[model samples]
Target: MPYLMRAEPYDASIGAVRPLFFSDLGFTSEPADSPSNTYFVRRIETPLAVRRSLFSGSAIGGYSETSFGSATLANDDGKLDWLSDLDWDGRLVEILYSPQERPALADFTVLFSGAAEQLVPGDEIEIQLRDLLVLLDVPASRGQFGGTGGVDGTAELRGRDKPWLIGRRRQIEPVLINAANNVYMVDPAGFSSLLAARDMGVTYPAAVGDFASYTALVAASLTGTNVATSKTAGLIRLGQKPNGRFTIDAEGVKVSGAWVYRFADLVRHVVTSMTTVTGASLLDVSFAAFNGLQPAVLGYWCDGSSVPKVRDVIDQLADSVGAYWGFGEDRLLSLGRYDGPAATADFEFTERTIIDLTPRPVDRRMKALKLGYRPFGVIFTADELDRVNVSAADLEAFQNEYRWTAVATNAAAAGASLLATEEEGKTLFDTEVAATAERDRRLSLFSAKRKAFDVVVPLTPGLTVGHTVKLTDSRFGLSGGWRGLVLEIERDANDETLKMTVQG
Candidate 1:
């Protein structure tokens, strides 16, 4: 006997609570002028694809194998089709309840039986079920529309299925034209037409009679456009003044005072080449005339209050564009303090003169050191040698004792012969006697030669005053000692000398 059991409620906060489905949300409105009759409704659609479970079960009846010659068993397959359509009724719940604000949806959970006791006898279950629905709401203000600025209006609401309709109608406004109070009353179309006509070379018309003549003259001076009222009177007039004067109310006004008249004079006198008369040329002429006018006139027009009244008119004329008239391109006219035909006086010639008498001569054999070349030795003559008390023997001794030669091949032979023949046979007394006799003979010959020939020795070529040259091969005294210069180069009447002024 089985006892009955009751099913208990599960916590909705857990995963077991079920969810509800929502179908649509939107708005409707009526026209303001015909609120009772005019109606409009907007539809929003939501379609959700249902999901299927992946698992199924099958059952089979048991049979005896001994009686089984040709018997077959049937199979039973069961699936949970009911779980696929599990409806969710409380899927979307509004939390904020403001009348003007749009509704907000809350989240939900599934609810189901947990134990097997919840099922009836012989019942089979294969899958679990759950659901969720999309939620949408229309704001109360947009759902019902009225008028703006007394014009009837209507709008349709939409939901999640048609999101483009939200807040779109409120974003439009009308544009107004010519609404400012300070605008002028001139006809825009007529002003544009006048500008077009002017661009097409049409001139403004003048009034009648003398007033028209005066106005036309003034306008002609300002801009080079002529306007005559009557077709019979030509707009342009040309004539030559033989008397160069016009009787105007018994007063004389120079025609040069008027820029237009002066410009005409310039056109005739200077700018004869109409082919070269361009806008820039006309502007240059106008600026020149304007600058050349009286300072009061110039100051009144150009606001140069600081310029002097008695400014030089020729200075202004020299600055003008056509001031070079009648002058060749190479010839320029001066107008300031330096003005005159440029002087062409010839350069004068005084007598071709020379000053400071002195002597200069050329002699190639003088042995004077030329400029930029250094001399190996300087020579002094005999008269100059007397300034220093050096005798001729002193210089000859230096030259002979300091003269050098490469070691000779026969030097060893000569030395051997001398030592063997002379040195081997000598007693001390005989050697001394022979050396003294030879020395006496040399002294006597040197003294006689010094007196008879006045033999002056040449200066050591590489030695200079106060400088020394080494004597490595001395015939007498120690070798490798230095010889010194005693005097500088000088010339006597007949010979050159470097006297032995000192010895080292």
Candidate 2:
């Protein structure tokens, strides 16, 4: 049978297939280290909290009352309740500090009735009731003030717009004309005696108690304890009053209070929660697309030595396309192992010709293995052989010069016509022979012949099928082709063999 010499590198005398190299294939060189493989960016975390407070009173009071009834001893108008018609409604105020000294400070005290009285020179009685009241009011006033600017509440009072109050009392009173007054008699010395006369008890406003509870409620509303409490405490101390209802302002304008849940905690919870949920070591929140389907398998018809670890080769292939995916290394080995033997044998036998010839003198009766080498001969179909476009004269010229064989139309047929034979047969044979010889001569003159034909026979890695692929090599003349998917990949550890089922 006539054989066709597949293109090879040394066949410069005849046309051969050339393989493409990396550079010639139009592939740009990738940096040894790619940013996609190394760079990792993380998101920033936010902060959050809750707060509470009590006694949100103002710096000014507008009401007071006085009464007098019993008087005893050598006392004058001793037992008395000196009262002023002043407003006591609490006003939200931001505290302010003053370095300047002014007489207005002294005059301001008159509004609160800052006065002192003494009954006797030796036996002293201090009528410093106004001073004591002022002293008690200072702490409450300080607490109401808020912010660095110390502006008393906002100019626009809270509760006025919403018609609702936050603390217990939320009403504005009218100014009274007549000064209501009262006088109570208690011998300066007997005042203490009266206190001793009956068991004394102090009463606190119910609203004050409620304010304490509300402060805590506000604090708890903040998510992160430390952050929440700190901010809430600041708002209360600063006594910031928003331009709305007292309750609304208190609830709304609080530090970081506008947040749903502490943003800081939310971030932490999301990252931590998702990590546990996914059961993945590396979890990332990104806008990149994720594939729901498993990766497809690709098969290559390569020599056993040329095929590396399947996983590595596949990964390299995937990397060329900037894809992020993973597969077990064993799977690649299995595919390579399974296809290795068949591919190796086919490549060796089809691409190379082995001649086993024995050279010996007619001496001892013995047999030995001797090796000889020759170029791969060309094979052509009978139809191609018949269509030789050459002249009879040319055929005689070439056949007389070189010992060339005329391929038979049918091997079973005998006595085919040859040169120096019958008219019709001679004519056909001469023409075909000349054409074939000339074709071979032209092939011999061609210089850039292929040394090897890197046939890429795509097979599936597993059960997957019909995968498209592009193979590029500057030194090789191959381009795009389709690769088959993988059906199964199995590895034999004991025998060190990898087997694979690839789509044909």
Candidate 3:
């Protein structure tokens, strides 16, 4: 791991790029995680990373720590004299030494607002500049000095891939796509038409390449030989007039108030609909294939009023396919996933890959699976919505199939557990099969967590979340075997230790 730290804040006022000259500074960012855009810095001279687009707001955020450490500064004149020209808001604090592979050393990492101290001469003038984290919360005036202004009004609150930003005391959310009224259309006409529509807006083959296109992938998983028009469910309600535009809080439109989609068409439609949410493209796609992931078809609803966040929608949809979706550098705009074979025990690990390991016990695995399908119309005036649920015909086969199987739902309350919500897979019958497939994939050695652990290893460059990794262990009968998905990675840039949450 080569040591590199650089802070370049654009000076929108001057119309040029200026690099911050840091006596010392460091930054850490995780584009893969939720709210992937953020950084922390402490510096000696001037702040970097500022932009006028964000006026009165310093690009640098702040953090403080006490009861942990101390810091003293020498004046710029290079003497024991009091510190001079103190501009704490955006200056990079320099580090004389940075040690690599040392998790305990915090020399070249971000700072915390806890457990620390800074000492300056009595005569010295000190200024406090914050890191970008604190910068998001600007203009803290208005409260009568107790100083806890509920939440900085100007601050942008984001989750998944959407910004839950406030305007006039209300949340303005990204819009959701309505299938009947979206940029893409549902064609009951089958394969060629479907492919044509997918490539319609394309100017280059690479731009709309067939490589892992969700449409192409779902086509592979198509249950029938071709599109079945009689079973296809069309839209009952498109949305408000300005289709594809964003809206505030909203719910998925009822699926034509009925289930008419051929199972194959339903899967195809939902997968295709997802790709239309703006900025759903990937930064880079691969020619390689991997395991534990198969090209999957997922079912979801798209409301016409607002455009949903691309990464967020893909994430929720990917779950249906036992796949993953998010950015690499993880900008608000981007998507990625691995759809291939069942998990094969690969990527062997030993002392070299495993830094710290802890074992945990998993209580139960579902033995039976009952997926409930709620129809589009007529909410139950009766006590149970279960009365009308469409059930999978093959629940018993699952019990005879898996090793440590538990019912997907309790038998008496069957049908509701997996299909608990009114998800718009209006494609009936086979949704049960899709849901069951998700369950089987989850029960796999790479997907199941009958054996699990938390391991802190060096950052493996290309490792993305939701991908499978093999852990060789003999204690839990995992000597000649053991593999699991990388559920979460706690990236520690300052400490240089990447902690991976494993499940299998």
Candidate 4:
């Protein structure tokens, strides 16, 4: 299908923005869009995120300042100036492109992040539209006409995305939660309270859509009590949120709520929640079940002092199930797990439908495993008065399997040490068992490789990232049904086909 595209520069400080130009030359590469990886730019002292490319093919037009081909901003392009306001680092150069060809801009659907710093000169002023935004325009370099005196080029225009209300974020001072901090039930309400505590407003439906009223939610480490109660606790950071969702103006914290069921739950919630989180609007809040789907009833709580950022909460939630999230379809957020339905081989692809394919070598660093155990089974027990007290140890023989084992250890890994976190289960044996199970799970998928291919297939319902696809060829050792998680899918406007990246 032919798609209509628009690229506009919007400023959150201003009301609305109009597209200065639209290009068929755009090639957007979104490696991942979940909160953990949806971060767009890396500033001067910051590290780079991913390898980005330019918007090749055609030139953009319409602005009077530099007629689609001007190198310098001789005339004031207010939006460009606004982005420059962020110094060298910037997100104001956002483009809202939609399939909808409408008169009013409010109806636009998908968001397009504008460009990175322009290295080469030309009319090639870049704008990024990515999981956040994507762009890096460079000229043919030489053979161009000069103004008059000497050879001149557009100064390397560097800027990041102007702050948008949706993904705007701020980081709280770090809080260590080792049984020494404030505590509360980090529920939708408790989470909202953290936002309120930060002077940010918290919004959610009175009744949780797909969530339950389960008693004894997860214990916390932020306050007083030790058990799963509101009295006292603390929290720890399971994962980190990217830099995008930090800033908010006087509006404080604007949150919309939604509920999704398990079986199809955490992955969908993390992906759609971050990407499609339209300002104050969240997923449908109707009291709908997963359509009679008897999936696991889910709700999460944590000490805000530890799991502070919104993305961190989502990341930690999904991490509990051995899953991590990133963007896939057109920078749409995605959450993928190491375990899914096994497809032994059938979904094969041949040279007829596959133009070319590239398989990435497994990065052991990305999937390192270090199982841990309590040297001596011990833990903190709560007293009758709700105070935390480190109880005694049981030195019983043959009580458990192996007392301790470092099954998946890599001694070369930056000076390895202990791999386990302190267990807080009711029984010391139960805690040790839980720790061992997690260790084995991580060992199974230690060698993971994400592959990308240029295919003639369209990215239909079954062909998106996170779906299973099979490959059969003597080259890729495809005798078995090697399943790979689709990491990215991009439509080639020129080829009129789709390209998919998958990780197995």
Q: What is the lDDT of candidate 4?
A: 0.30
Q: What is the C-alpha lDDT of each candidate?
A: 0.19, 0.18, 0.31, 0.30
Question: Model 3: number of clashes?
Answer: 53
Question: Which has the higher TM-score value, candidate number 1 or candidate number 3?
Answer: 3
The C-alpha stretches of model 2 lying farther than 4 A from their native spots are 1-481, 501-504
User: Candidate 2 residues 1-504, lDDT tens each?
Assistant: 000000111223334422111110112222452211221111101000101000011100111111101101111333211111111112111101112233121111111111121112111111111111111122101112121221222333221111110111101111111111111111100100110000011111121111122235243332211111122222221122112211101111111232211212221222222222121322222111211111111111111112233223323222211222211211110011111112111111111121111111111111111111111111222332222443444333322322233332221111221211110011111123332432232222211111212222211122111121222333223223212222222322122222232221
lDDT of 1 at 398: 21
Give me the candidate number with maximum lDDT.
3
Q: Weakest 10 consecutive residues, lDDT, candidate 3? A: 58-67
Candidate 3 per-residue C-alpha lDDT over 353-438 given as tens digits, one digit per residue, 9 for 90 to 100: 67888876543433344333211211212222122231332122211212222234333223323422211121111234555555
What residue runs in model 1 are displaced by over 4 Å at the alpha carbon?
1-259, 262-265, 268-276, 279-290, 293-504
Best first by lDDT, ranked = 3, 4, 1, 2
Q: Each model's TM-score, in the order given?
A: 0.12, 0.13, 0.40, 0.40
Question: Model 3: runs farther than 4 Å from truth?
Answer: 6-10, 15-312, 329-347, 373-449, 473-481
- Choose 1 or 2, whichever is better by TM-score: 2
Badly placed stretches (over 4 Å) of model 4 are 1-4, 11-14, 19-21, 25-122, 132-308, 327-334, 340-348, 358-360, 363-390, 394-464, 477-483, 488-504
lDDT of 4 at 163: 14
lDDT (C-alpha) at residue 418 in model 1: 38
Q: Which ranking of candidates, highest TM-score first? A: 4, 3, 2, 1
- For candidate 4, the 10 contiguous residues with the lowest summed lDDT are 61-70
Worst 10 residues of 2 by lDDT: 191-200
